[model samples]
Every structure is written in structure tokens, then in C-alpha cells.
Target chain A: MILNIPFSDIVFYFVAVFMVLLSIAAVSSKNVLRSAIFLIASFLGTAILYLLLKAEFMAMAQIMLYVGGVVVFIIFAILLTSHLGENKLSTPISQKFLAVFLALTLLGVMAKFLFNTKELSESITQKSPEASSLIAYGERLLSYAPNGFVLPFEIISILLFMTLVVAITIAKKDNKEEK
Target chain B: MLPSVTHPIGDFVRENVPNVLGYLPDFIQPYIPSAEIATLINIIICMVAIAVVGIAPVPVLIYMERKVCAHIQCRLGPMRLGPHGVLQLVADIAKLLFKEVYAPKGADKFLFYLAPIFVLTAPFLNLCVIPFDKNLQVADLSVAIPFILAMNGFGILSTLLGGWASNNKYSLISSLRSGAQIISYEISFAMILLLVVMLAGSASLGEITASQSGHFWDWWIFKAPVLGLLAFIMFLVSSTAELNRAPFDIAEAEQELTGGFHTEYNGMAFAMFYLAEYINLFTTSCIATVCFLGGYHAPTIGILAIDNILNFVPGIVWFLGKTFFVVWIYMMFRWTFVRPRVDQLMALEWKFLLPVNLLLLIFGVVFLAFGWILP
Candidate 1:
């Protein structure tokens, strides 16, 4: 007897497959626009999974902001940056081999780690994990751990501030060279 | 002024809904066939609530506008139609309906007509998720805000498509302005939306409204002032632009872009767009209430000891009260405020509003991590 998969499960699988395919195409495609579009597809697929996981906010974050803003910006920048020089960006076999080796090794290590740990491995088996709502997520993020993750949160803020400063300084004309 | 008159809608609702357990859908309704019919009867009534309540607002809104403008300008407004011109809108609608629709020589006949339908689709759809009473929602989809946002897009597209199809140069310019302003504001509007999503936990409109109930402090407006404040501002700016209202009303800027997008449309074809514009104002206010202010939850005036008794107040009353206050705020901001230039509008969005919105989002997340309150 054949077991019937739930509609949601089938949808989740289809999205996952589509995401993997799009991600591969994102890396391999020669057309930059095609790559950006593929990346958006991957982002959307991931967002659907996030929605299925009941992380609605994160799902939209993936879609509206990341896909809508960041990807749109990247595509626009790429368009603005000029499309004339395709040959200049082409790389050789040695760089490709090195990247392939690094990726394969990283994947192998992750696969091995998954194989080794039973408790960590079991958690990965969950298809649909019950997650917090936006409010619940908010409260838990803030109030759960006694002292809270206040230090880390503050540090992240500082890091964001420093990054902003550095980005502006770099984006501005080279001051040291000018001096 | 009456301190706190518990609204009449709740009592009206109890009379409408049979309280007996048999009136409910499960087992109790089976013995008495009439009780079984009550739930179905309520569902049918629930569906028509939009038709009954939604269209009434357009006429009432017009009357309010007239009264408000009259007061501001120091003039006596329409006193001719049934008392203080309450039926003035009804007369206006009757006149508008019979007027001959003049299509421009250059306009695509179908799309020019279709624009009105597209514009009205949003307000009609807004009626879907609005919780009139506890069980009175059309589609309590888990993702109502996004659904509403999607509906808003359709409304924006109508203007764009309408202008483009007209083949008129000024009309095209107006449409482009509408597109630019609405699309740009949507990003920041969305970031603020995410902050609300973060606060409320769930995207379901009902969940967000329910979160605000029982007490004052539990309301999201007080939960995180930053989130509420940022979302409020973004919703305000975006809704203004979305409705094509000033100073973002550059779409219909009479002096510069001529009649802007509607330069080609006339008579009944034009009236549809006009009707839609007014309806959109109400839609945005309703959205603002749900997103930033807890929709329909009463403001702090007194402590409620018997909470079970008070949930009895029809949800629609809260929905309308919050919606009206927001609409009033928007009207004040528009008319009382000086309009900015188009360049300033774009700059305000890209340079100032967007960055502030982004920072507010991060702040919201940080507030969450600090054990600000129990979720």
C-alpha cells in the first residue's frame, strides 16, 4: 500500500528542490541578471519554508526586504555598474578547482558531523517544528534568559555602528591617500 | 460628555446571536432544527456586513469632510439635505451615477473603465479580514496583513495602468508619480510592518487585535513605543502616498502635470476613481489601527474587573473608533500641514525615512532580546 503525503509536505519538498536547483543555477549562470533572478527564486523558496515553519515575519524578511530590497539593489547596481565587461571577470580552472575542493570538504565535514551526533541529528529530523509567534518570539528573544542576551545585543548594535562608519569612510574618497 | 458608554453594537449583537449552546454548530444545535439554522443565518449575515457597513462609510466620510472643511474655512456647509446635510452624499452619488461617462479620443476604452474596478478592489477586500464581531470575519487567514498589502498593490496598479492606457502625456506623468511614491513608501512601510509582525508574533489580524485586549498596557502601542511610533509614521506617509493624497498628491497636481493621470477621464468613468480614492482613505486608517494601534481595543479610561462580560462589546465598534481617529489624524496632517515638493518627497523617503525605519527595526529586535516584556 502506498502512503499518501500531506499537501503541505509535498509543497515543502517541491520548494526545497526548486530552491536547490535555483541556487545551483545562481552559481553557474553566465548572465548576472539570471543569477540575481535565481537568487530571488532561492530566497522565495526559503521564505515559503519559513512560512511553513510558522516563522511568518522571517518569511517576509526573506521576501519583501531581502528579495525586494537587497536583491533589487544588487541588480540595479549591477545594471548601473555597467554590463560592458564580461570577459574581464572570467576566472581560470585552478580557482574553480580550489573552490570545488573547499565546498566539497565543507559539505563532507557537515555530513560527518550530522552522522556522528545523535541528539543534534534527531533535531534535524523535525519536518514542522512549532515556533513562536512574532510577539512570543520578541518576548523570548528579550526576556527568556535571566540577564537576557543584552551584552550580545549591544555588541551587535555597536558592530553595526562601526560597520556603518567604516562603510561610509570607505565609500567616501580615500582620505589617507588624499592626505 | 459621557465618560464611558459601553457601545450599543454589543447589545445589538447579542440580540442578533442566540446565546444558547444549541445555537452553536456542534451537538447542541441538532435537537432543535431552528438552533441549527442560527449559525448558518449568522454566516450569511456576516457576509453582508461589509455591503451594509462598508459603503455607508464613503457617504458618511464625504459628509465629515464637508463639515470639517466648512469649520476650517469659516463657512456654513450643505444644510439643505435632510438636517445638517447628512444626505448630501446620497444626493451626490445619485447625480454622479447618472452622469454621462466621456472617454477621451486617445484612451483605451476598456482599461480606462477597468481602472475604477481595480481601485475599488482593495477597499472591498479590506472588508474581508475586518473583525466586525468575534466570529464575524470573512477570511481570518493567518496572513491578513500581507494579504492586505497585496491588495494595496492591486489598488496602486490600477492608477498606473489607468494612466498608461489613457495615452495622454499628463496622465502618464501622474501615473508615474503615483507609482514612484507608492512603491518607494512601500519599502519603509514594509519594514515597519515587520516590526509589528515581530511584536505581535503572528501575522493573523485577529491574533494582533486579540493581543491588545483585556487591559491598556497589554496593548501593542504601549508594548514598545519605538515599534509603534515608527510603524505609525511609516503607515501615515505610505497611506497618504497610497491614496495619492497631498503633498504626495503630485499625481493629480493640477498646475504642473495638468490634470495628471485623470486628464483623459470624465463623468462616470472619473466618478469611479473618485469613489475609490475616498474608500482607500478608510482602508488605510483601518490598517493603521490594526498594525500600530491595537484595533478596536478601548483606550485606558477605567479598569475592567469582569473581562468576560466586556469581550461582549462588538469588535466592529473598536475597529471603527480606531479607524476614525487615524483618519482624523491623516486629515489634520494633510490639510493643516504645508505640502512638500516632489524632490523633497523622494529624499524624505530614501534618505531619512528608510534609514530611520531600518534602525527602528534593529531596535525592535534588540528590545525583544532585552526581556522587555513577556511575549
Candidate 2:
């Protein structure tokens, strides 16, 4: 029997494999900066997967926010904390066997859960009939209806505002102390 | 055969290729999938065309910049290099191509090589969305504005990677500055673009252009009058900062950074950065043209006779003319303004442009809500 797979599924698997590899590299990299760069690669791979899923807006947002904003912020933090030229940046593996055992057990549990979830497989196989246009996405995001994201959106905005305020206050306090 | 060609340029080229290919003999034509071949051929042709169009103007733009600066400074510029330095860019390109490529001892070899490719790809990818004529755009994605912004955002990585990979202090500092500067200005830039998107009622470039069609009064700049003008100015300022042009060019401030993020780049690698910059300049100008300057539409101040006459001129002409005009203005700004300090640059965006853009966005939403926009 011949195996039948859609083009999008092929793209999805390709991106997923790369994303997983990049994620592992990101975590396992000895250099902090290299780890951050690897994280960017993983984020980009996820963005491609989003594209394959036909979520163009989400894909672009992923790139714009993750690869652009968060990754750059992480890189900046890495630069600030570490001497980039120095090679002795890796952490010592204090409990290597215990860590490996825990990681393997967690992976196994996740695999078992994933395989056992019938609803998850069903959802994966059945593509959504209606693809929301960008305008509809915007409307739904701002709407106050039952399924609308207005509350969460507003909450996120307020959270961001509060974070900004706290950060500014802390920075100002530091400047004052220095003075 | 190709489902009724909408793009005149694409159609014309598509028609000519197969005819030309026909002379290659029966074997080649038979092997080709005749129905799907036009699209495949068109895609290749467009790729080549966009690359050519993107790069071909660099030398001319560079020459124009030098001459403009020279005239501004009351001096002769490249008088010997073929008719007021027309061939100067050619000579410069040759010099750059032959210049030795070098990497510092501590540089990350892989990333060091990759940075220039990133720089070059961003603007080239951006060139695809710009609607030159009614159907001339390569890809008319609905989220053209966001796509362009995202591509540009990715460009910051190249600077960051270039700086980090170079392992040079100055380069690192410049890259950090660029990263910070780009991210900060991007907020205001996106806000301004959102205002256009809101006003146009669609995110597609073609749709925005279509809405602004007919007369000069129909153009967004003149349609909404005060709000339109304000948005245009805000977009210009934010986009200028986004492009890292003066007075927002502290990232690569020559006096201090000595070439900034690309301080370690040499030869063709350096040229790639330079090429990307100019291409970016063009792309930004083109966006401004499409979003604000009524794109390819001829200006018609409600005069029927004048409008008819204007209609006789093809759209590509108007589009290129308007885009170049904006490009010229950007060039003028580069020579005219002094560079702002880094603090001033950040302050300008966070303090002034951001608030103004937010207010403009609010006003645009309100106008759009009430149907006060022009038809």
C-alpha cells in the first residue's frame, strides 16, 4: 500500500524536525550567545510551521515578536551578563544521571499522553473549515462576544503597561542611587 | 491560456518568452508543460526582474547622492568619471569587487559569512509586495504591511549577528544600538502603517492603492486632509528612523563607531551591507509612495479633461516617478540633516513620535468609524 501525505503535512514535518533539533541545540549549546542564536533558529522554524498551517498573520507575528523582540532582548541580556570571548561559560553537570533520568521519564510521559489523547489526533486530522481572514481575526480579538478575546487582550495590555511602569521606576531608582 | 493575465507587464513578457522559446526547436517545447510553464516562467522572470530592478538603480542612486552632496557643499564631484561621474559607481563597484575579503581572528566564521546574506535578502523580499502597476506586484499578500515589517524586523538580526560574530567592540556596540533603535522605532512605524490600514479598510497594498484611486483629492494624503498629512509626516519620520538614516543613524555614526555594526566587514561583504542600505532606502520610499502618495494614480484635482489626459500615461511611469521623488527627498534629508545622538534618537521616538502616532491612530479609527473617510 502506498502512503498518501499532503504537501502541507510534508512541510509541517520538515519544519517540526528542524525546530526540535534547533531547540535541543539551543538548550545544549555551551556558549550562552550561541544558545540564544540557536533559540532564534528554533523560533524561525516554528514560524515556518505556522506558515505551513496557513496562519500567515500568526507566522509573521511569531517572527516579529520572537525572533525580533524576545530573541534580541535575550541576546542583549546574554551580552550584558557574560564575557562573549571567554570559552568557559558552560555550567557543571552536578547530577548528570538524575537529570537524564528525569528528562527521559518526562519525555516518555509526554509521548504517552500525546499518543493516548484521541481528541488531539481527531483535531489534527480534521482541518478547520473556515479560515479566518485577518480582518475577522482583528474583529474577534476586539469583540466583546462570548468567544471574543477582548478581555484577555485588554488584560495583556494592562499587564504590559504595569511592567513598563515597574521597569521605569526601577531604572530611575538605580539612576538616583548612582547619583 | 494563463487564466486571463491581469498584469500588463507580466502578460507582455509571458507572451514573448514562449515565442522566443519556440525558436529553440521542437524538442525543448515538447518537454515543457505548456499550460503550467507560463506561471513557472513568469515566476523566474519576475525574480530576475526584481533583482535587476533592485540592484540596477544602486549605482545611479549612489552617483546622485554624491553629486547632490557635492553641489550642496559647493564642490565638483567626480567630474572625470564619465560625464559628471556617471561611470564613478562602475569604477567603485569594480574596486569593491576586487577588494580583499578579510575576517578578524576571533570572528564566528559561519555567522560572519551569513550576516550579509540576511542583510541582502530582507529588502529583496520586500520588493515583491510593492504594486508598481495595477497587477505588477509579484506577491500581493493580504498582510503586505505586516509582512514587510516582519521582513525588516528580521533584518535587525543580520546587524546583531554581524556585530556579535565580528567579535569587535565597536561592531558589537553598533549592532546593539541598531537593534535597540530599530525595535523602538518599529512601534511607531507599525502604528503609522496601521493607521493607513485602518483608513484603507484593507491591509493589502493593492486594495489601499485602489481605494486611493481617481483624483488627487481621493489620495489619502489629501482625502483626509489634516489627519492624512500628519500621518504622512509621522510615517516619514518613523520610517527614516527605521531605515537608520540621519538623524537616526547613530548606530553607524562614522565619527564614533567607525562604520558601526559593519565595522569588521570588508570588500564584497561590506558592499552587501551598502547595497542593502540603498535597496532599503528605495523600498521604504516605495512604501511611502504606495501608502501615502496615491501610488501609481495621476493627480487629478477634480478636472475631467485633466484626468483623461493623465489616464493616457501608463501606471508604471507614475509609480516610478513618485517613488523616485520620495527617494530624492530621502537623499536630500541625508545630506541636509545632522545626526542625532543616541539618547536624542530614543527620546525622539519614545517621547514625541510614539504619542503623536498613537493620537493619529485614535483619530484614524474614529474617522473610519464615523465614515468620514473619502470614497
Candidate 3:
């Protein structure tokens, strides 16, 4: 069985295990900063999984956005807050149950999706999508034809612009108040 | 459509390096698996090459910076170590290696240990995608630009972590400053690179470098004339801030934050951060060389004899020369300029550089649209 196993499968399983461990560590850690670091590690593991799947762009985006931007921002918030990792947080039993229930439901849904999707199963058994170059990726992202992401992309850009404007306005108001 | 490298070193590894694997004794070959062994050997060779290329110059760079700063200040720097103090860094490194490594009380032990390592890895990760020469890059990933940006984010994270883990107020404040500065400047840095990508029509570093493989004027710094020059200057400014050098080095301002994020680090751990900084300096200069200057491509005048002679020199030499020239500029800035206030640093990036970057990007787009690229 070991001889029969493909090298890629071994790498995939290794990354999956690593990610699972990291996620567990993140959720179970008492120190908020430690949890955040663990979360970054999980994100990094996900990036490696993307690389294994030959989704280079997805991997880079994973690192750039989640591990790099979101987690760092979270750490900044944590550092700036009054309590710096000294909080002995305890979840109420009811809330913990609810979390578990919701988590199980989500896991079930994801598992169902994975097992029932014939296309995904077939694609996984075969070669995954060919690694597309950035040129093609950009073209598809900006193209106006069917299958193009242009409209949604533009909408997202507008949304981000609004968010930026709101953030700036709020920040400026706070500054003026302080002044 | 993976971008192809014209002179990829991978072929050399495949054709030549695997032969050495064949000499393995028959007794060991069956158990070890020759094919896997070959791949491992190839990977090791690549890693060694990357480490050598990315890290080996750090000592020399440190020495060079010291010398340049001293000369600029009209002082003799490190004259006793060796001839012209060439071995000064060697002695310094030895001292660092033997120093006590310790974490302060109340410090996060794990993070305190991990921070230097994480920070050190960022530049090496960045060096992977940089096309030093046509064949010298470790991996020419299609998402090289984004990868580099992500690595910059990684660097910032490590800095923040180092500061927080230090359990020192000065370290925290300095790291906070560093995080803010780097995150702000990163926007301009990414924008300038994006402008280059738009002109080159490819985000792959290898392809971008290949696109400029012609006359010197064809380089991105000259190709679009005013906009190109503007973009290059903006890149330099933003990258200087990114590197946290003088004028923009408000993060580790000695007058305020004692040793910055690395205040708690000692011994080789401190040296790791130091080495990472210089490596990052080299990597950024290399990026500047690849993007703005003709990467590895020799500059040529129209004179046939001169052009031929220039072309005869290898691309790696030209690549290193341009990179070091940019590095020299970075050193000059550190010594010559006065450090700005933290508020001023923020203002400079958010107010001045950001707008200029956006305008330059627009101008670059317009130039490209009108076919006004200089030949």
C-alpha cells in the first residue's frame, strides 16, 4: 500500500494533518496572541495545500490576504487593546454546545458537498485544473464575456472603495475629536 | 500558459545532476529509491544555490554599508580587522555566534524564539522569485509579484511579533511604528510594481526581465520617459521606507526606541535580524534592478564593438552590478537624509506618495494605451 501511494497524496495528507493540528491549536490556546499565531500557521498550511493543488495564485492570495493582512490586523487590535493576552476566557456551556452544533452542521454540509459532487470527485481523481498563467487569469478576471469575473470584480472594487471612504471618515472624525 | 524561462537552470539540474545519483552503490539504491534520491539531490542543490545567492553577500553588504556610512561622514570605518577592515564582519559574526541567547522574563518564550527565524526567512522567500539572471532564479512562479507582496506582509508580521514577544515597551512601540510604516509604504511599493507589470504585460519576474532584454532605454525606468522615471523614484522612496532605512527609519529611531523590535534579542538571534535586514536590502535592490533596470541584460551603446564587448560579459555580473548600484543608492540615502518624525512619515506616504503613485499608474496606463513606450 505504501509503495502504491503516490507522492502527491502523501504530501496532501501531510498538509491536511498539519492544518488540522494548527486549527485545533488555534482554537484551544488560552493566550490570544498564541492563538493568532496558530491561526497564521493554519493559514500558511492552507497556502501549502493550494500549492500542492498547483493553484499558485490561490496560494499567494491565501498568504497575502489571510495570514499577512487579516491576521496581522487582528494582532494589531489585540496589542492595542487594554488586555494583552492575560484574559482567562471561558466559554459558557450553552454557547460551547451551540458552537459545536453549528460547527458539526457546517462540517456535515461540507462533507456532503465533497462526497456528492461528481465533477469535483472526477476532477480530483484525474488531474486538477491546469495551472493557468497570470495573463490568462487577468484576462478572465477582466473579460466582459460569459464566465468573466469583470462585473463582480468591479462591484467588489466599489464595495472596497466605500469601505475605505467610511474608514477614512471615521478615522478623521476621531482625530478631529482628539484635536 | 506557465511563463517559460529561456535559460532555466532546471534543465541543467535534470540533465547533469541526476547522473551523480547513478553512482550510488547497488545495495543502497534499492532501499533508498534512486528517483526520489535524484529529486532530493536536485532540491538540495537548488536550496544551496538560493542560500548562496541570497545570503552569501550579507557580510560584504554589511561591511560595504559601514564603509559607505563612515566615508560619507568623513571617518575611517573598521580599519583594523583586515586589509581595509574587510574581515570586520567576520569578527563581528563570530562574536555574535558565541554570545548568550536569552529571553527576558514575562516574554512569550515560543514567539520570542520564533520571531527572529520568521523574520529571517522572509527575505529568502522573496529571493526565490527574483530573476537574478536568466537562469539563476529558484522558482519563476506566475504570481511572483503577489508572492513578493505577501512576503513583505510576512516580514511585517515577524516584526510585530518580535516586538510584542520582547515584553519591552520600547520594542512594542517601535514595532508598532514599523508595522504602520511598512504597511503604508507597501501600498506604494505594490502600486509601482503593478505599473511595471502593466507595461510588461506579465507579472512573472522572469518574463518581466526577459521583456527588457534589449537596448538600455528599453528598461522600464526609461521606456515610458517621465512616468517611468516617476514610478522608479516612487519605488525607491517606498522601498526605502519598506526597508526601514534612514529618513524613513522612524521605526527604530535610536533617539526613541532603544533597539526597536529586536531589543530583546541577543547573540545569533539578533544577528539573524541583522542579516535579514541586509538580505532584504539586497533583495529590494535586486527587485529594483529587475523591474526598473535591465535585469542581467547588459547595457549597450549603438557602437558595434562596444555593444559586442558588453554582451560578452555574463548576465549574472550585470545583474549583480545593477543590484549593488541600487544598494549603494539605498546606503547613500541612509547616511545623507535626516530621519522624519513618525507623523511626518505617515503623512508622506498617505498624502504624497500614494497620490503620486496612483497618478503615475494612470499615466503609465495611458502611455501604454497610446503606444508611447520608448524603444
Candidate 4:
């Protein structure tokens, strides 16, 4: 029997495999800065997966916020704090062993849950609607309906504004104190 | 199913490639699947086209920069290489490519090598979404505007990584400055882009251009009168700062940072950074043209006769003409203005541009909602 595979399936598997591998590398890398850079690679892999899933808006947002904003911020912090040539950044072997064990156990549990869910949902999967457009996502986000995200969106915005305000106030106070 | 070739240039090339391939032996031809061959050829052609658009103009732009600067300073520039020293850039490129690729002992070898690749890729990827002419775009993703923003945003990583990997004080400081400056200006830049998207009621670059089609007056810069004009100016200013072009180029202030984030880079790696910068400048200018200048559209003042005459000219020519005009304006700014100090650059973004941009965005939203924009 011949196996006929679609192009998208190939891309999906490629991205998925890379995403998992990069995520592990991101967590396991010795150098903190290198780890941060690896995290960006992981983020990019995830973005590609999003693209393969045909969620272009989410893919771009993933790159913009995760790779562009968060990862850069992480790199900045790493650069400002770490000594580049020093070998002091690596974790102890015992801690590394613990991390690997915990990761494997979590993966096992997730795999079990995923299989069970897949078995349960296989019958109903075809009834699921297609992914909504970005416009629909926006409308849903701003909607005040029963399942709307308006409150969460507003709360998040307010929280962000407060963080900005507090950050500026603290920075200004530091400047004044220095003066 | 065969993909319909919509672009004139693409169609011309597509029609010719199979004929060229047909001349090869039957054994060689049968070895390659027809579908795969076509797809491969198309991909190659696309990459070449994009590279030509992104990289081919760098030499000319560099020449223009030197000439413009020299003329401004009342000195003749590059009169030796070719006519008016046009080949000067060619010589410089050749020299740079052959020059030794160097890394300081303290540099992070991996990042030091990877930084230039990232820097070069960012601008080239960003070029994919630009509607060069109607149907000439490589991809017209529905989220093209955000995609462009995201790709351009990733450019900061190159500078940051390059500086960090160099292990030089000057490079580190400049990279930090670049990171901060780019992030700060991106807010205002995004605001301006959002204003444009709202006006057009679409985030797709092609759709945005389509909405603005018709007379010169229909261009977004003039479509909403005061608000559109302000948004254009805001976009121009913010984008200039975003690109780290002077007078906002504190990141690469020669006296302060030596060669800036790329201080340790030499030879082809340095050339990559230079090429990326020029390509980015070109992309920004192209985006500005597309967003505000009605893209490749000819100015039609509703006069049918003149409009007909104007339409005789193909769109790609108009696109290039308008884009170069914007590029010239940017070149003028580089030579004409003094570089701003870092503090002043921050203040300009935070104290002035941000507030003004936010206000302009509100105005734009209201106007758009009220259907007050020009037809």
C-alpha cells in the first residue's frame, strides 16, 4: 500500500518536531544567554506550527510578542547580568538529573491524558467548526456577551497600564534619589 | 492544479522555464517530477526576484548617499570609478567580500557567526509582503501588516545578539540603546500603522492599496486631510527612528560607540549588516509609498483624459518612482540633520511623538467611524 501525504502534514510534523526539540534545548542549555537564544528558536518553531495550522494572526503575534518582545527582554537581562566567559552559569548535575526525571514523568502523564482525550473526542471531532477569522477573534475579545472576553481584556489592559505607571514612578524616584 | 500566474514578469519567466528545461535529455527530464520541477523553478525565481529587489539597489543607494552627502558638503564624491564613481560601491563590495572574517577572542563564537545571518534575513523576509505592483507581491497574507511588523521587530535580536556576542563595551552599550530606541519608537510606528489600517478597514497591504486607488487626492496622506497628513508624518518620523537612521541614530553614534553593535564584525559579516540596513531603508520607503502614496497608482484627478494617459504607464514603474522619491527624502534627512543625543531621542518618542500619535489615533478612529474620510 502506498502512503499519500499532503504537503501541510509534512510541514506540520517538521515544525512540531523542531518545536519540541528546541524547547528542550532552551531549558537544558548551559549558558543563560544561549538558553535565551534557544528559547527564541523554540518560539519561532511554535510560530511556524501556528502558520501551518493556518492561524496567521496568532503566528505573527507569537513572533512579535514572544520572540521579539519577551525573548529580547530576556536576552537583555542575561547580557546585563551575566559574565560571558564564566562557566558559573551551568547547573549542578544532581539538579539536572532531577529536572530530566520530572520532565519525563510529566511527559508520560500528558501522553496518557492526550491519548484518552483523543479516544473520547474522535467521534465528535468532525462536528467542530473551522478556526475563526482574526476579525471574529477581535469581536469576540471585545464582546460583552456571556462568553465574551471583554472583562479579561480590560483587566489585562489596566494591569499593563499600572505596571507601566509603577515602573516609570520607580525609575523617576531612583533618578531623583541619585540626583 | 497549476497555479495561475498573475504577475506579468512571473508569467513571462514561468512560460520560458519549461521551454528551457525541455532542451535537456529525456532521461534527465523523467528523473524529475514535472510538479516538483515547476515548484522548484518557481521558488528559485521568486528568491532571485526578491533578492534583486532587496539587494540590487544597495550599490546605487550607497552611491546616492555618498554623492548626496558630498554635494551637501560641497565636495565631488567618487568621480573615478565608472561615470560619477558609480562603480565605487561595486569595488567596496568586492573588497569587503574578500576581506577576512574576524572574531575577537572574547566573542561568543556561535552568536558572533549567527548574528549577521539574522540581520540579513530580517529585511529580506519583510520584503515578501510588500506589494511591489498589483499581483507582483510574493505573499499577500491577510495579516501582512502585522507580519511585516513582526519580522521587522525580530531585527532587534540581530543587533542585540551581535553586541552581546562581541564582548565589547561600546557594542554592548549601543545594542542596549538600539533595543530601547527600537522598542520605544515601535509603539508610535504601530499606532500610525493601526491608523492606516483603520482608515482602509483592512490589514492586508494589497487591500489597503486597493482602497486608496484613484486620483492622487485619494491617497491616504491626503484622504483624511489633517489627520492623515499627521499620521504620515508620524509614521515617517517613527520609522526613521525605528530604522536607527539619523538624526535618531544614537545607537551607532561614531564618536561614542565606534562601529556600534557591529563593532567586532569585519568583512562579509559587516557587509551583511550594511546590506540589511539599506534593504530595511528601502522596505520602509516602499511601505510608506504603499500606505500613503497610493502604491503603484497613477495620480488621477478624476479627469478621464489625463487619467487614461497616466494609466498608460505600468504600475511597477510608478511604484519604483514613488519609492525612490521617498528614499531620496530619507537620504536628504541623513545628510541634512545632526544626530540627536540618546536622551533627546527618548524624550522625542515618549514626551512628544507618543502623546501626539495617540491623539491622532483617536482622531483617526473617530473620523473613520463617522465615515468622514475622503472617497
Among the numbered candidates, top TM-score falls to 3
Rank order (by TM-score, best first): 3, 4, 2, 1
- lDDT (10s digit) by residue, model 3, range B80-130: 977999988888888999999999999999999888889877798888788
Q: Could you tell me every candidate's TM-score relative to the true structure?
A: 0.63, 0.87, 0.93, 0.90
lDDT: worst 10-residue window of model 3 chain B: B1-10
Stretches of candidate 4 above 4 Å error?
A119-130, A144-148, A158-179, B1-40
Question: For candidate 2, lDDT tens digit of each residue in B1-375?
Answer: 012226776677668766766777775556654434566677787789789979987877788778887988999888898887788888888999999998999788878988999898779988988888876778777778888888886688888889889989999899989889998888888889989998888888989999998888888987886999898888888888888887788889989988899999999999999999999988898999999999989887777898888988999899888888888888788888888888778767766787677688779888878878877
TM-score of chain A by itself in each prediction? 0.71, 0.74, 0.82, 0.79
Q: Write the residue-wise lDDT of candidate 1 on B1-375 in tens digits.
A: 000112344334445555554457785453443432453554555557766666778877778777877877788789998899888877887887887876678665665777777777778777777665566566565666765665566565567667766878788778777777877787677677767877777777778787776566666766776566656777788678767876678889888888877778776777778878777788778778876677777554354655545556666787787788888887776677666788778767766776787788788888888967434
TM-score of chain B of 4: 0.91
Candidate 1 lDDT tens digits, A1-179: 01333345666778989999999988887766557657866987887887666676566456556654566556545434443225444679999999999999999999998888877434222643335345455556566378466567778878986875465456344545767
True contacts kept of each: 0.02, 0.33, 0.48, 0.47
Question: Over the true interface residues, superposed, what is the Cα RMSD of model 2?
Answer: 5.9
Q: What is the interface RMSD of each candidate, in Å?
A: 10.9, 5.9, 3.5, 4.5
For model 4, what is the error of residue B226's alpha carbon versus the real structure, in angstroms, after optimal superposition?
A: 0.8
B336: Cα error in model 3, Å: 1.5
Question: What's model 3's TM-score?
Answer: 0.93
Residue B351 in candidate 4, Cα distance off native in Å: 1.5
Candidate 2 vs candidate 3: the TM-score winner is 3
Model 4, span A116-172: residue lDDT tens: 775544432233223544676778899999989999999998898677557555655
Between candidates 1 and 2, the one scoring higher on lDDT is 2
**Prediction RMSDs, each to the true structure:** 10.7, 4.5, 2.8, 3.8
lDDT of 1 at B93: 77
